[model samples]
Target: MNIATRTLLVATAALTGLAGTALPAASSTTGAPTTASNSCPVKAWGYRGHYMCGTKLKAGYIDWNRDGRTDEVFVIAPNRHIWHTWKNAGGWKEMPGRGRADDMVGDNGTGSRSRCIIVYVIKKGYRYYQNCHYNGRWHNWTTSG
Candidate 1:
């Protein structure tokens, strides 16, 4: 092929490849990937160092790594479960899981640089139980009796 035709074909192929792959849209505020869908109910909230999800049945942030700093923002998904979205070097990512996070406090000494996550979960009938995320994973439920 001629130089001009070859260049055009290469450009077309590049464009086609991009079109076939879905790119994560970026946010103007944090420049992170806007991977959380519209189904997430807490996009308007901006994490202000620390926030507690409380009485109003609202949304807040969780220090999943327990660095005593805001790490991920929690939102109630359309499925009625809580999901966390956080940004790293790779941009924003949604933490996958089930159930509502009713409350959380302290790191419980489960991590190196951060506090462990001590979360209270709501399981059927407005009941909540405490659980700890230690050593990079969640321990079994400690039901509130």
Candidate 2:
């Protein structure tokens, strides 16, 4: 075969191998739970550890905070409990009040997965919050005006 053709084949092979390696990382997002319990079902309101709060939480898309744009939420769960934090137009803020904001129990044979537990706050004019869980911790984010 021509040198150019062989070189093209080698480059294609290298690219194919690289692409294959990346697929696993992409699929890893759907893998097992990192720190939180995979079997915990999210409840609307329940006991999350010592703190009573909301459950079955899911992170929402990023949006404007009164001041301007902000970073996304980040969460971590080491084991039973989840910890959350976020960056806002104002700055970084940890969730207020100590305690679990939400709780979850394993779901029955309904074929549904465990629910997410999260905490949030709403003021007179402001409404709603965003949240996410990653690396064994929970993150809560919101916009304020």
Candidate models: Cα lDDT each: 0.39, 0.28
Give the clashing residue pairs of candidate 1, or none: 66-114, 66-115, 67-114, 67-115, 107-115, 107-116
Query: In candidate 2, which residue ranges exceed 4 Å CA deviation?
Result: 1-36, 39-57, 60-62, 66-70, 74-82, 85-96, 103-145
Model 1 residue 91 distance off true place after TM-score fit, in angstroms: 6.9
Candidate 2 structure quality by residue, lDDT tens digits, 49-138: 111123433331122232344223222222213333234223212232222212222111121232133333222332333333344553
Poorest 10 consecutive residues by lDDT, candidate 1: 47-56
lDDT of 1 by residue, 55-133 (tens): 2223245555557776555443322233344555232333333333434432344445433333443433434434444
